[model samples]
Target chain A: MNILVCVKQVPDTNEIKIDPDTNTLIRDGVPSIVNPFDGYALEAAARIKDNAPDTKIVVLSMGPQQAETALCECLAIAADKAYLVTDRAFGGSDTLATSYILSKAIEKVEELENEKFDAVFCGKQAIDGDTAQVGPELAEHLGYPQVTCALEVKSEADGLHVYREAEDGKEVIGVKTPCLITFTKPSFDPRFPTIKRKIAARKAKIAQLTAAELTSIDPAHAGLKGSPTKVKRTYVPPRKEAGVVVKEETVEASAHKLFDLLSKAHVI
Target chain B: MPNYLKVTPEIIAELEKAAPGRVVTGADVNPDYSKDEMPIYGVRMPDVSIDAQSTEEVSAIMKICYEHDIPVTTRGAGTGLVGGCTPICGGVVICTMRMNRILSYDLENFAVTVQPGVLLQQLAEDALKHGCMYPPDPGEKMATLGGNVATNAGGMRAVKYGCTRDYVRAMTVVLPNGEITRFGGTVSKTSSGYSLVNLMIGSEGTLGIITELTLKLIPAPQATVSLMAPFEDLAACISVVPKFFMKHYQPQALEFFEKEILVSSEQYLGKQVFPRKIEGTDIGAYLLITFDGNSMEELDPIVESASEMLLEEGALDVLVADTPPKLKDIWAARSSFLEGIEEQTKLLDECDVVVPVNKIAPYVEFVDEAKKNYDFEVKYFGHAGDGNLHIYECSTDMDREEFKKQVREFLDSIYRKTMEFGGQISGEHGIGLGKVHYLEEAAGSVNMGLMLGIKKVFDPKLILNPGKVCMKL
Candidate 1:
């Protein structure tokens, strides 16, 4: 079985600084990291291959050249191959255009490998954009059934078994082969990359695809020109409420008080 | 023993008059003020706890205590492991934590002036904001700079950047006579007079109270990388540390510990980052090394060579943690080992002895062998690069008296062995009241007499932190 994991590089939120005058992120000295959820998505894919040695994993990302660092990390962690779909024409793409480009690149990747992927995995949401439309939209474009908030995935006889997070609790659902799965954060971090793998990853050449090479896409339906949505402006949201912490005699008392308060508001 | 004056209402009133609302007495005092982190030594509540806010306030408190013939123990955040801030004499414990303030920065001289009560974590963070780094990185980040200076505290980075004493450029100290005097200066070279600054650095609060400090800072390193190497046994693990220096890896920190201790930390933090086994073999010990340089490009070759060296020396495998989050997790686990042990053990005693780096493996092996005859469980870990070992004797099942007796014997043996190896009894933890006997044994009568002579010159009344360090109370 072969899998393709999608990853993205975003500014590390912990170290993020905002420009006081411009009200925009000060990215000058801020470090970039592989979106944490995407790392977990890759970890989910890696774990499946860990239990089943024959499973192959490939990782793809769409960004500028610096995004290759994220893909290299993906390879070091266990990706069998890496692809960077970067082109100047793909600039200013929104969720719809980004998903369209990714779906087209997924097809191109399939043709290059000459093998159909058994599953597609992605982070449920990129932390920077917080727009969760891409994964489900990619699945729509690929015409494959998809599951969101996949806590774990296991390979079965004819399909894949996925444990997805639900409102009440986890709900286990089985999906057939050639499906797509989006992942949230896992309990543990992704495994550490071995020395040999890290050294090899540092030197590995990533396959880059351009808009011109992906001939199936017409310029009319790609990049900024294709997207109809526009973000007029954005400003940091003002913090309106600070959380209230209850001081009680014991934890049980605190919990009871919290439950009573919540039930009074008909939330429980 | 010297007769110590008791705290009276009159004396407490005088202290309150000196420091205003910052003085607390009797039942009003918090229990934490009675002891330091290592409570096993002993605990005694001071009659009056004064939160001195400035050098003049400290001077006023000291003058009152001096006139009353009361012993005064200056305390910081009370994070000391050697009872250096315990206030065992029990007259007055002057806590300087509230005096914590960053005074100024001399950018030209690369020095920052701060109140003694300013914590290590605060100074380290504030310095980084100015694009400078304070080199002394002690494990207890919450410990105040005053306490660190008094103990001459050393930590993980001591192997590379040196210790607290190396960073202290000048200080304003209030002596027992209520005289505030300045020591050294913000000069790169000082040879004009007696080194009073160096003397007060590790005097353990016996001579004077550190009021303010001018600490030297260096440019911050651009990148840092940590690598962990697991070995089949500790001998193989520790023996490879000295080789890093010989091969010139210039590791910022080199620490080695057994798998069981890591398991304890894992339980405490509810986080698992280290492996218990590798390649189907149980990991006996791991050597954690950190490298910092101008950039990752500069550290890359150093990390590669160090990893290769460890693998050649019977390592299971070398793992790299160049990313910030991964490195932070590894160090968080390392820094919390003391808390982890404290939570699990009912009775605990620790000995921080620093020997020659080359003797670390043999010393570790000797401790392992010596534990067979003792009833308590022995857990040991230390800086492999600096040769300072924190070997703990712990027991949850033994009676308190029995544990105390056995631990005494155990400490006697360890301290004796430490001296035989030309090692110091207390590496970073000073000779507070708890370990004065061991310090006496290690320093010998003649050397101890010199220290006592020096102590008397500064504190003639012997009222400042009596019964600690070289002073015979």
Candidate 2:
């Protein structure tokens, strides 16, 4: 069975600094990184490949020219191949447009490979935006079975058994082949790429496909025009002002004052 | 020439449906998730990021990825000195920020259970509330518990309290197979088969993802005194460290700073640490010694004896201060040394090399002489009691690229010298991405083989933070 993994390149949010003047993100000098959650997806896929050596694992990413770095990382992790969907027309695409374009790109890839994807895996969400909508949207568009917030996965001769996170506990679900999955954090700790694989990934060339190259696509279904939501303003939240400090002469007095403050704040 | 991995619309749709509200895609990906504190390297951002609050959430995410075969990287506060936290591979980055809750604190057992994302400073403050202290202070106040465990970080207090590994009583780790297993426990000691807890301590997030940790705490020092002793010559200061140990002064902390480091530190703290400047006198080094005990009466004799010993051995005046604020000021200067060194250099790379206590003098002399041969200026300071020294090097007149090359050579030479004296390549900072190559040399062939074998046993898929610590898999 052929498996596909969707990965994306994002900015390392920990290193992000906001442009105070404009209240917007400062992209310059900020490093790009692979969405950390994708490692679990890759690890999961690699496990499946290990369990069945004949299985083929493919990685897909959508981003600018620099996005190939993410694919290279996947290759280092033993992904058999990688594909990049990059086009100026795809710029400023939102989750809706991204899912649409990626769906098309994956379709084109299937046709080119002359095979069908048995399953697709994705990290539950990206850290920067925190808006986890693409995976479900992609699953919806493809009309395939999907399991979200997955923590555990076991493959059987019939299909796959997955453990997903619920509100208070976990829910076990089984899906047949050709399903999609969105991983939850701490699912399985992602594996590190071996040295041999890293060397191969470093030299692996990523295939790039522009919007036009992704088959007959409508111009209206690309870029900003295809995006349904637009960000209007961004600003940093104000710093919390220090509260009044009540001083007391003795430890008992201080404790009473602390109790009073807690009472006033209704904390106890 | 393109090596392409396939993604399908069916998979994307399934992922979206599964995670109704958390997934991020396309231009929604922000830039801040890309890099770490390492100054030289540029950013490499993740395509998607996730904030997981529970083990189930993490496991669910892993199950999906396992089916499709995606790469993932884990991140904490991103205060890493090396590139270990950078998702050099752009996939999913699981941010532990939301998982920062202190789960439990048992004062009786002297143990605290905390989520991996909890900050060290927060833990220290919380521990202090109960008249206890978490002694593993790694300088960076914002570093997370998980990051500390990942790196097995040590700091000035390591001379007394030991590093993170010493205090880690238990851990909840997520394996590559998405299994959340508990290792070790609240029990003080264990003789388990593999000691997976110890193995994971300095694994650099390769073996497993640490979700929660139970750390041991100690009673706070009751009465503390700090002293600053100025030496007329560098040899005297270096020679006095081992003497303190031999005399059994039992100092909680013993640190040494050269003239350059002291002056820079003073400037950084914006306060005069030394009573008077000994200018043009070629004063080589200054030592800061601190003693802590249960009572002032108990500490007074020890402080007096240490002072008398220093005076007798070095013939230099030793100033002792017991006032809280005054002692705090002196410590502030010492802790601010890293920033001061950064302020004084155009570019700097630090070597956290540790040597045998007796070899401290020889190692310092060797590094001092080697400085003249190198293309950069070198400054030395650190926890002298533990023989762990931070030797920082920066460009003198060379360009950036040349300076980096020379810095590598200088560090290589120092590592060689350290090994000859039975020393470690890193005393506090674990073998993150920066020290991977050196770790191989330091661990030698036999140890490296064992480490690799263990890595395979714990992480068969090699999916945990790749390219860190033990070379890939």
Q: Specify the poorest-scoring 10-residue window by lDDT in model 1 chain B.
A: B1-10
Alpha carbon deviation, residue B325, candidate 2 (Å): 1.0
TM-scores for every candidate against the unseen true structure: 0.96, 0.61
Q: Mind giving the per-residue lDDT tens digits that candidate 1 earns over B1-473?
A: 66777888888888888989888888888788899888888898887888888899999999998998998888999988778777777888888899999999998889999998899999999999898999998889999999999999999999998989999999999999999999989999888879999999999999899999999999989899899888989998988877988888888999989988888988888888887778689999989999999998898788888888888999998888877677888898899888889989998889899999888877777888778888999998898889999998888899988888888888898788888888888889888877888988888899999999999899988999888888755
The model with the greatest DockQ is: 1
What 10-residue stretch in candidate 2 chain B is worst by lDDT? B1-10
Chain B only, TM-score of each candidate: 0.98, 0.92
Model 1, residue B423: C-alpha shift (Å): 1.5
- The DockQ scores of all candidates, in the order shown, are 0.60, 0.01
The CA lDDT at B206 in model 1 is 91
lDDT of 1 at A144: 96
